[model samples]
Target: MAIAEALLAASPQSACTAMIDFSGRVSKNPKLDIRAPGKLSLSHLLGWQGYRMLALLLSDVLALKMAWQIAAHFNQFYSPLPPELNWGSWLRLPSLFWLFAAATLLFFAYGGLYSSATQWKNYLRAGKLVSMVYLLSLVMGYFYDPKLDPPRSLFFTAWFGSVVLVIGFRLLTTLILRQFEQSQSPIPVFLIAPGDRLATLSHLLEQQLNFKGQSASHYQVVGAALATTAHTPTTVQTILASKAKEVLVENLPDTALASALYWQLRRHGITLRLLPSSVDMLHRRGLPEIFAGLPTLRVEPRFLSSLEYGLKRSIDVFGALVGVILLSPLFVAVAIASRLSSPGPIFFRQERMGLHGKVFHMWKFRTMVTEAEALQAQLEACNEIKGGVMFKIRHDPRITRFGRFLRSTSIDELPQLFNVLLGQMSLVGPRPLPLRDVERFDTWHHIRHQVLPGITGLWQVSGRSDIADFGDAVRLDLYYIDNWSLNLDLDILVETCRIVLFGKGAY
Candidate 1:
């Protein structure tokens, strides 16, 4: 088949779908699109990868210069320069040294030393490239200028110094960058394999690395699909919905299946990583290594690194503080309305489970009668949620006329910003469930306790009170935990705003 014909034949998608699901809801707006779907460019240097590259580059430059200085110092010790050539001149690099330094950097770049490739992060590569550059410079210098004869002491010392220093500097850079990588988010990955291999692939992808008594996985499986359904639009939608940066596929039934999925993901700027059945293909496409005693291909995702979790907390504090200040007027209005509509305090304080099952008082504008909790036993029969782990009533008798508007608009939750500022809650995360709700939670349901509870979350934006089953809500919470990212938080916040404005799912 012709090349174009082969590519066209492999792609199974009918057309590119412009719409993307933010949180179980479709968003057609391309502007607020919060996905980093495309490959990296100059702009990427502004992020985590860029910081790494810059560190390596600076290290290389320093290594090269230090090598030159060391070479000069050694030559001076053995064969002192004449009175005419001062110590400064003896230490200064000649034009020839500058030429060789330039060539060394060029060779390093050619060998992918400054790129995002993990294999090139080792000192061995840097040493090899430095040796090659020095050797090539020697051979070319001999040919270009036959009379160019430097002292043997200076020549060999510089050559050896260049290789050793470059390697040493790079190793140092790796140690420093490793500290930052430990705190960064795992690369979000989607798995595609036969049903039998799906679990194995997920386990491997989520394998944790131990560093300084702390363990963290480099990859997080956000979604998975059987290879049989890999080419379907539903699978494609699931991958996109998960906001996966890379899709890893293995043991495809046919080459076309892989090709088609690749094309579909490529269109959305998502990367397709392959684990070929044959050794030759694995070597060509990915880094082959022993994973869990099984030979496997390591296809690293090109992810940006930074102190994103710290940044998230910083944003939470700043946003919560600003929110309280700006919304104080609304707070007073709601307080007055609640006071006049019902005989109760303006703020309702309930004990809610927070991070690691710690109990804290979560504040909310009162949206029910003062006797609401006392009356809950009588309304259990009318509970709308199937599991009853959570108590919910679409239209409860306890809601006063003014409280209904507060509940519908989500104005009742504004007081929780205090919890956020107090460090008990976040601006975005799994919502904190009441102590009554926590008492009935299944073992797995408490996994949401691992992170700080939030004012809004995937559960609140996905279906809110519209969801009938608590299990489905817990599943969404799990998904949020697995696929958590700064962008995902922002997307949830945007979706929350839209939902609140329209009052789509709230009681």
Candidate 2:
């Protein structure tokens, strides 16, 4: 295509001599029709995406040089190049290092590292890519230079350092780019789905917001067209008036209608994307293929391996220790307040369902009378939040005067750091439930207990005690588990702090 385009662009007649279909068959296109489906204007095609790959390649090479210098600093045989001198040293990397640089970039590209539009934001995947590149480099080195005259330590340190530096560079660059991007207007989008599913689809799209719901002052939903086409003229007018750049069609509509709509919408140059037929099962990544002219998606395995669990536990331990130390003063203050204001033990320990329904003593700073649990049955009839496995009562009689304050402030949850440190919980996971609540849970409800519980979770941060529907809470937990990553944990932690500090939805 590039060759054809160049030939046409250079021709005196300014006409194309041939058109190549996807089948590799050459045909006449004397009319210079370049609007083929798989082709685009060269400038637009080579825009930011090509530049992004080049930038990543440069970053990887720089990371390689930095890794080598840092590794060499620790090796007894090599003299480390100082910072000012390293500028020229990077350009003079050993001939073998040049080979390594090319291989690293190619390996990363092969590993899907260079493909992410927001590479820095996808740190976990990028980290895995870095490890792959490093491992590949090690294997290459072993075969190509077995003796490793520069020292094996050099390669090892460089491997670790490349991961750190490459990620760090991407992280900082992503932040800057994200800030710049937010200033630009979002492309208008038209949603074509069953009216009943509009609300759910809206919420899903808004999750792509910078800050879900709140900071989303501007909405990308420019218009809506019902799949049923109840009012065809209205839908067409809305689409035309809104000038939507994209149309999202739900899988509910028949292919004939989707095809008709696509033909009508494509005339306006609106990109069309069909919503997955099975949104639930496609929550994680999948292998996309074509089967007999129809798109096919195969779901990937959802289980976490032992190594992932071990890494998750290690992070939980470290985060818990840091949190406990940082909040020791608040913990002591809450403990003292609980004893003085509630006339109960400083800590409240109750048997709660942990992983796989294993009972564990979940600890919290007492935020109720000593006999609050005993009074729970009496107040059952008056429970304000209904139709949920968990029970809650507005203006409960059992909450002590200070207990109310403690609960509202979420200080009651401070002691859970100990549970996290003890390995009975994680810093971010499904919140553990009391045995009474567990007893009321259905079989499907037991799924939340598959992972260690936490003090703060998707439910707590999303709506906290305000969420009355047990099924809704369970769904959020499952979604978290299915898509678990370090970025998600950080997001939840930040959101939890915001909710706790604002006293939103707390009793």
Compared with the true structure, all predictions reach lDDT values of 0.70, 0.60
lDDT for 429 in candidate 1 is 90
RMSD values for the candidates in order, in angstroms, are: 18.4, 20.2
Candidate 1 minimal-lDDT segment of 10 residues: 18-27
**Candidate 2 residue runs with Cα over 4 Å from true position:** 1-279, 291-294, 299-311
Backbone clashes in model 1, listed as residue pairs: 37-269, 48-305
Candidate 2 C-alpha lDDT tens digits along 359-457: 789888777888999889888888665564788887998888988898898888878889888777788888888878877776456656545678788
Best by lDDT: 1
lDDT of 1 by residue, 13-68 (tens): 43234212212122232222122244334534665666877888789888988887
Alpha carbon lDDT at 77, candidate 1: 73
RMSD in angstroms, candidate 2? Answer: 20.2
State the displacement of the C-alpha of residue 270, model 1, in Å, after optimal TM-score superposition. Answer: 26
